[model samples]
Target chain A: MTDTTTLSVEELTQIVTRIFSQNGLSALQAEAVAAVIVAGERDACKSHGIYRIEGCLQTVRAGKVAPQAEPELIDDGSALLRVDAKGAFSPAAFAIGAPVLAQRAKDQGIAALAINSCTHFSALWPEVEALTGMGLAALAMCPSYSTVAPAGGTQPLLGTNPLAFGWPRPDHPPYVFDFATSVAARGEIELHRRAGKPIPEGWAIGPDGTPTTDPEDALAGAMLTFGGHKGSAISTMIELLAGAMIGDLTSPEALDYLGTTSLSPHHGELVIAFSPEKFAAGRGGDPFSRAELLFSAILGQGARLPSQRRFSARETSLRSGIRLSAAEMAMLNEFLAAA
Target chain B: MTDTTTLSVEELTQIVTRIFSQNGLSALQAEAVAAVIVAGERDACKSHGIYRIEGCLQTVRAGKVAPQAEPELIDDGSALLRVDAKGAFSPAAFAIGAPVLAQRAKDQGIAALAINSCTHFSALWPEVEALTGMGLAALAMCPSYSTVAPAGGTQPLLGTNPLAFGWPRPDHPPYVFDFATSVAARGEIELHRRAGKPIPEGWAIGPDGTPTTDPEDALAGAMLTFGGHKGSAISTMIELLAGAMIGDLTSPEALDYLGTTSLSPHHGELVIAFSPEKFAAGRGGDPFSRAELLFSAILGQGARLPSQRRFSARETSLRSGIRLSAAEMAMLNEFLAAA
Candidate 1:
């Protein structure tokens, strides 16, 4: 059997933070970034876990991100909060704005946060979950680099924009879901290409604008939006709301500025928070208890909640530590040495 | 060609308003309901047009709706606005609250409106469009009676929940999209059954939890969500935010209370409005012009925007009055004669 190393969540977070700090990130940036990456690993979401460290490092090395920049919160005392990342990693920006956002939601019953000029590479779940942890319902979305096409179109005009939402639950993990609007994420297509496998039909189109299953062809062309036109419309909305409306880069503009998809895309993100207590006030039922009934009915029908797998994995990780393969360990050591 | 009738938009509205007024709806409710129905017919959305009138009458006759109940707006001057429909049709409630919601959005950068205890039967596009007309971006959602199964399960535990979004445009019709989050709308399946045809595979499952294509079997069973798990997650978010969080009926709860789907379901709605001007306050570009570039790029790629068909139909209806087929004309006359 291959060798493996088990590490506690705290241990892993420490190592990750050191790597970022050693490479040039400020303490705040390193710690905030490390938390999300470690959370990803703890939840068994390997895609967003340690595997993303190299991308973060690459982005830093290319001088694309301000490693030491401190995100500034521009709160005008309205229902909207703006965080200027000043071209830094998104996690730090989000970290600085989330608490204020939650407080504003409580005060106003609804609030929105706009994080601008950041290189965003993390899943939105962590941000939404933060609000949920604060006893609020949250929605988050952002536009990535252009790689997905609108439905019935061949060119990459829209990003594989991800939309995430979370609802607080008492004495249980919150209801959370984060997903790319693409039929399949670009990373999934890349994996198929690396494995010499054909992608499923409808995932992408050839450069010539025809349906394509060949992974290489899809990589050269564009990914399709999920649910066809409905998904495309949603992706477009994300571009308008999170990108353009926030006075940030649209997917195509980001691609043009970056020139390649290898580096993290620089853009803005929008997160909206709603206070359930405020929304349900003077109404008949307790929102949290009513939500439980809906959840139970869903589970009773054998339908799985979106993050059940992640939540369960989290439970195991908390109890038994995180297990990393020998290859992963070697990669981490090499990164540390380089730093 | 069959004999048909053509009527100006105002004429149709008058007729529809008269029918509702005659059927016991208060003038406030009657006029608001007529406006939406006329708008739907003008836009060629027959599914939500005059066809919905019979359902409304059925609900009124069954004493399930308070026809003369006046909607009350409860605003605490925060970002959230509430409209209690008092068991009347939803349009009047929305009409009463929309202006305040728009003003709040403008002042606070973002705001939400919750309409409770309403009999909702109209498509969400009209409400979203109203906000867009006021130069605000809007999102609206609500639960219907349970008719669709959550992804990965067989039983119907979720509604074919409708999600609608709108973004303002400077010199054009606003970008708007409204769709049911199901593989196929329940009405489509009913139509197939009436026509003795089969539904496409993946649209639904039979009562035994097996995939089915027979229209009859599918109607007796449960419908599937669009885009599989992703769409299911969005539908669930609607249930949490618009239903339970707002202290209104969830899909199953609505079904349980109504005991049938033939009448308009009594539930609540959530509409959030965002001010692009407030959001793009100090950003580099104008949100509206930037949006135009994105829209141009999408159309440049040969892909169509979401409401192109509806917009074009609306133009035709405006230039030359709305055209109704003989059958539709006969139906309207029959209702008028009865009244």
Candidate 2:
């Protein structure tokens, strides 16, 4: 068995923040980014946890991200708010805009915040949960570099765009779900390739436009969207709303700008907030109570709600410390030392 | 070959309107409902077309849907608009609220319309198309009577909820996709049962919660959501936003209220509209033109857009009237004579 380490979320966050701050990131960007990474670890979402620190540093090293650039918020007194990240990392921009977006949603009953020109490497749950924490339902989506193919098409024209949503639960943690639109994430294919295992069919298509199970071949070609045409349509909508409508890089354009996916994708994001109280004002039942009933029905049927496991892990981590493999600890130490 | 009759779109609309009006519906209600049914026929969506007219009449005959309940719009001048459908057919409620929703979206950058107490029998594309026609992107979703199981559960606890999205195009038909979240529509299973054919795997589970291909068993059991857990999550979101949050019956509640799925489900609908011009304000490029590039890339890769087939069929139908089978013509004549 491998050795392991346990650390409080705050301790780990401080170390990660220090690494980014020491390297190049401004205090605002470093702290904001660290909070998301630590939240992932706290929730046991290892994919977005400490494992992502290297990618953030690499993007900074590649000079593709402006580490010290400040995010600027532009509000025209409309429900729409814009945050120009000035090519910085996304966490800072989101932090600067989320509160305002929540206020706007409350005032207008619905609002949207568009974050542009940022390097987005984190999952959207953190951002949505932030809004849900403020008693508002939220939806966030963004395009990555081109990696997935549209349904019935051969080439990779769509990104594995991620969509995340959250609804506040007065008596419990917020209901949340964040997922990539693709059948599988690129990292999963990379893992399969590293393990010399064949990927499952329907996960990807080869460059020749035929479905393939070989991880390497799949990597060379394009990933497929989940649910075939339905998933593809939603993915395309994300590109249009989060990418084109926001006047930022589309999947292909993002890829062209970066010339490679090795570093984080620099793109924009769209987050919409809805005030449930305002929406349910003149309606029948209490929205939150009604939501609980639906949730209970789902649980009573033996189906789990999305993010239940994460919330459970979070509870455990709050009581104890987050457990980490020895290798993960070593990597963190190395980053700290290097910085 | 089956003998067929052809009729102009307007002619068919008039016939359908006459049937509804003569049967029971007021002129306002009849015209709105007929328009949606005609649009389905015009788009060649047979499942939602003239075949659905019988269901609407059945719903009215059952006294489950009001034939003359004028929809009341309650607007607080906020971004959220509500139309109390007053147990009437949904088409009329949507018609009464769509223009106000469009204007609110334009004024606020984002807006939502909550349609409550409506008996929804039509598809959501028409509602979305209405807003898209006003140069806004629209999203619509609503719950139906329970007939689907959650991703990991056995019993039916969710609806075959539909999600529809529309994006405007300057020179072409607006980009649109409307689909049920279920792996397959319940009608498809019914058709398979009628044909004595088995359903495909992953479409449903037997009452025991085990996967089954037998159409009859699947129908008696529960249908699954598309894309496994991901689709289930989306379906659940629809229930929350359109059902619970909107202060109306959820899928199970609708089923309980109706006690059967033979008639249209009485529930609420949620439609959100976004002004692309408002969202893309102070951003770099024209959102519409940028979207065209993305669309071209998809088409360039031999992938077709979601509504292209429907659009093409619509073009053909508009030029040379909608062709219906002789049996279909007889059915229409019977309805008219009976009314």
Candidate whose DockQ is highest:
1
Show the colliding residue pairs in model 2: none
**DockQ versus reference, model 1:** 0.90
Give the winner by TM-score: 1
Fnat per model, in the order shown: 0.89, 0.84
For every prediction, compared with the true complex, DockQ reads 0.90, 0.83
lDDT per residue as tens, model 2, B1-339: 459889999999999999999989989899999999999999999988999999999988889998999999999888889999999899999999999999999988889999999999999999899899999999999999889999899989899999999999999999999999999999999999999999999999998989999998998999999999999999999998898878888999999999998889999999999999988877768999999999998999999999899999999999999999989999999999998
Q: Write the per-residue lDDT of candidate 1 for residues A281-307, one digit (tens) a residue.
A: 999789999999999998998889999
Interface RMSD of each: 0.6, 0.9
User: How many pairs collide in each candidate, listed in order?
Assistant: 0, 0
Best by lDDT: 1
Error of 2 at B306 (Å): 0.9
